[model samples]
Target chain A: MSSPLAKPQIIAHIQKSLNYTVFDSKWIPCSAKFVCLGNFARGTGVMQIYEVQHGEAQLVKEVEKPKPIKCGTYGATSLQQRHIATGDFDGNLNIWNLESPEVAVYSAKAHKEIINCIDGVGGLGIGDGAPEIATGSRDGTVKIWDPRQRDTPVANMEPIEGETKRDCWTVAFGHAFNDQDRCVCAGYDNGDIKLFDLRNMSLRWETNIKNGVCCVEFDRKDINMNKLVATSLEGKFHVFDLRTQHSTKGFASVSEKAHKSTIWQVKHLPQNRDIFMTAGGAGNLHLWKYEYPAQRSKKDSDGVDVGVAGTVNLLQNVTLSTQPIASLDWSPDKQGLCVCSSFDQCVRVLIVTKLNVV
Target chain B: MTAEEFVSLQNQGAVIDYNGKVPVEHLDYGYIEKCKDVKYLEKILKVLRSGEEGIYPDLISFCETRLELLDPKNRLLITDKPVTTAASLSKDEWGQIVDDLKMWQEESKKTEDSLKHQPLLNDIIKENIPPIRGSNQSVDIQQKQNKNHCKRPLPRDYQEWDKFDVEKECEQIDSNSSTTSDTPAIVNTGLSKLRTTLDASFLAEREQLNLATREKDKGNEAFRAKDYEEAIAYYSRSISILPTIIAHNNRAQAEIKLKHWNNAMKDCQRVLKMEPGNIKALLRRATVYTNTGRFETAAEDLRTVLKQEPQNPAALKLLSETELKLQDEGMIKKKRKGKKILIEEVDGDDGHNEKRQGGLKGEIFWVLYIINHLSHNLYNT
Candidate 1:
């Protein structure tokens, strides 16, 4: 009931020219360097690695591929290796060694169509299990790949023969670090979100938002299942509490209207789990904070413990340009420092001050 | 000064000699008295005592401009009290005041009720329902008749739909058709059976082979598109349907694109077993072996390919690269041995005792060494 806290000030540090339509950006693990993947005017994908130097993004390395890259992640492999796994429009998944950018160290044809999203887990020296990557494609299938196994995927999720195939817009890995158990959460174009358990090889849970879901992300990849934020079309996003599950009602969730247009992506700060930022189709960036309930679960009439959902509070918003922000990444080593790419063919390095206070 | 004297001096517009040596200005007694009631005189006196003479003339003018209203008699006229006589009071005035207060309270209560019960404007405007006419009257009459009718009694005999035998109907149809038909039907049935047997034996294998080729063609299309994963899948499917050297060789190429060294090597091996003269398979297998640190095997494969095609540029280049890699590997081995000997010498004295004492540092050094070695290997590869 009380008014939310005063919004934080977003200070734009440096706006760099990408000269291409940037589709995705990701920060290298344990470094100030970040990678931006974009498409050139000729339709080829270009990956540029930039380092944050004196409030400016300095281009460190650039590699151009024959196909357009849709997404990339650094979570699957170890931080020491610094291998970046990327999915391309040609359905090829490739892992590049940062030291050698001329060619990928590992590559595979991962899907039948363009890969819409990719995520990785069990890396960063946090878990005992081997690192794995999950990719969702426009072909309507989500496949999990262990890089050590080169010939085929470790697991594949496709529609049954009689069922209609839906485009998978996003995929995420969660509940991975502490235990060997891991689950892949995928978002479909039909508003369906499915959580597939890798250990049991079955769909653990599924729910629909009645609107196309664009992106799905777990709060932290190296922790147990804690929270999930899913962004959808029509300017809405939902936060689900994963600590408790009900028999009839699944994980408790609360929906909130974010930007006035579609939210393209939502990324939680690497330093703070409760804080996250959403990039909107209207080129607006909104900072949000999740407030957890004092008691996560309570007994129902049937004596079953039901999860109590938390609330999402808007903290700040800033409009950088007129074009929609396609992708953004927060530096894992530096607090409040982030890089985001927009449809305007420019990548901006921003610093959100006073985030440590939140 | 006395009130009478102050008024007499003000009328004369002259000074009053207080001590014969200094003359003090006469003040308006009425104005002074009015100022005292409002506490303005005390503020003016405080200002005067501070010796700020610049504000004195303004204060004096303010008093003079309002001299008529400041008259004591005029003040008394405006301050008159209401008359206490009963003749001046209105009849039932207290009752009327109470009634008005109650009426106001009731009006506020009505407003509060309206606010609580008011429907949304959109909902109110959207509601439009027409009254039901003759159709409802007929339905009501029918319902009334149905209610008046008595319920039927249960029958003792019961029949189940599942009790009927479906085969008996088919048998009756078959008997009727057979009786009407003759030798032509039997001949047609016999010929169809023979044709089915012949197709099963001769065409099945060829059909499977055709399907495999189709799958292989799909794999080739995917490979051209650079979708090596799909190509690999298609090629695998083709191999599963009917094992062929072409499918295996194609899968190996896709695997090589993916940098699946072990898988590519296995595929190449399968192809070479089918046709030992496959130069493409040999070269691909040699590249895989070179990537996986099997230099000797890679050299052997390159030698075989060079023998088959002496003028092949790809094979020639790969052979030179393999030789350079082998030399580098030899140097790395020598360096590792040198480091191992140095470590051995450092811990040679009281071998068991020194090892226990320096184990932590040694382990840390080994980890750093291994990391450095691995990074170096990665750069060369």
Candidate 2:
């Protein structure tokens, strides 16, 4: 609902409690349905599909497996298929068909330990390239998978044989402007964010924010490199200007501290790139807007060019549940519509009123 | 547009009165559309049209766009022309500029041959440019453009997503032999060669096997507690998960204890087909046949069991009973005097030994399970 004379507001549209402990939730594209991923108390991974019907979340389908699910992505699947690729506690990657869901569409043993985060690109008509999924796991590796290939990842990023492996916590795909231009940003628990160039199969840029990174996301998946927002385990979040990267220094970034606790997730509004909402560990949601600076790049010392950082302003803040909100996603087709999962075992549908005006 | 509507919306807690004041110009399009008063729009349109052209250019265009939908005649006159200026001008110069504008528009229309690829309808106005998705640049739009075929299925199955041959991929793994640490060697799904590889399908298979074994153990537990019906049910569940000769034989033994002679016979046939000349299956089937009064077949099965294991006391005792029944039924000539002595000796400890055999029957499930497990290990090696 729009409050035309008033400013935009965040409204809790629907809240439903689940039996299992929810770890992640995502909105399915072009539909009113969303998927909730979690583990039952008895150690079974449960994937529950719910559709928003009559202002209520209706259970559409439920599937269970032997492992606990950690993360999932729809970016590697076409709109017609509507498959979900998920990572589980057993280090197994499985793509499921929502229709039958009795067997996986494709499966692979992608890692030796739990997979922490997964992102995908080149699907849903978003990118003009091969649809590939990138998964970062506790095994200290980032692997890219193509559903066309069975049982093996198409690309992998890892350390040398004997080096101590840092746990990879989050991953996201950006700069997918065309078939040849794609990059994967993987955040590790050791405060490192590595930008891997998929076309060249090399690490392009990397830097640490001095705190464990909890989540990373691009403003839009189809456009050229523009902005990336990452939240930390501490009460800090950084917004990086992906348009420019200096030779010695990495991309310029602006950091902000809020919520006074862990910032669990940061999701940009699907209809507006400049606006994003961060879910906090103390059961609060803070909305922020990024304002571009006058000049994006200028000559630094020694006549070398360096990038400029933008400023962020808080739009609103509200407390919903008294537990950490682990995952949040804005609906692809509906502006200001979102679904979030929290440690309170609740999945909530929210309407951030008047996102267009924001 | 209306004071009453504004007050109602304000009371509804959506809009707030800033410092207890309301401004007409600050109200957005959604609020105005909700009011749906045409006179309110008309009043604003009249004021915009009468104002200075440059000062109200945006409002002038907005009013024309909205009003043209209500009046089609005004639409023809509102085509692509700049708003008329209000400043005083000499008649001759104004006429000259007007004629120049018309001539340029006519020349552009006549010179259409210069613009190739006419399908791209580019608007001269910068604000009228369509979004990238509307420009047929995205992949899905291009696909939908050329499609004259039937629609793809909704919520496609995984098999519909790609034409990937899984067995062929495994075969390629065999030929290439490019084994990296993380890139596992994916073997054929049906082949037991999957045991050494930590493939996901193999893990899924092992998970099923563990569940089946658990069911089998529960069946054995039920059998120990003298719940033959529940034991048969659990055995059936285990068989449904993964068919094993041991499970069938165990189920057959339970069915025989329940006096389900026909079901026991069917289960024994299954075990025998899986492992031909199996001594336990032969003995169980002979017992079933003897219970059902098929003395000839029982004798034949017992004879086969004795040939495999001569010290099989259960088979020997059953054989003597079968022969005695055959003799009573007149199906056998009672002329072998040595056979009679052997039968008498086999029947000597019949009552006490039968109870001992029945006690040993309970251990067969564990023994068969261990044997099957060992055979599996041997196969993997």
lDDT of 2 by residue, A1-358 (tens): 2343344566676789999999999987656679999999999999999977655799989999999999999997755466899999989999998788999999999999999999888665454467788888999888888777777777778876687889999999987755576788888888888888776666777788889999999876755566899999888999988766776666889998866689989998765678899999987888888877777666777555677888887766778788899999988665677899999999998766556665
> Highest lDDT, which number?
2
How would the docking of model 1 be graded?
A: incorrect
- Alpha-carbon lDDT, every model: 0.70, 0.72
Off by over 4 Å in 2: A1-5, B1-381
lDDT per residue for candidate 1 within B274-326, as digits (tens), equals: 89969999999989988889887899999999888899899899889999999
Please give me the DockQ of candidate 1 compared with the native complex: 0.01
Q: What is the lDDT of residue B219 in candidate 2?
A: 64
Docking level for model 2: incorrect
Considering just the first chain, candidate 2 attains a TM-score of 0.98
Runs with alpha carbons beyond 4 Å of true place in candidate 1: A1-7, A126-128, B1-381
Residue A241 displacement (Å), model 2: 0.6
Report the lDDT of model 1 for residue B123.
33
Winning model by TM-score: 2
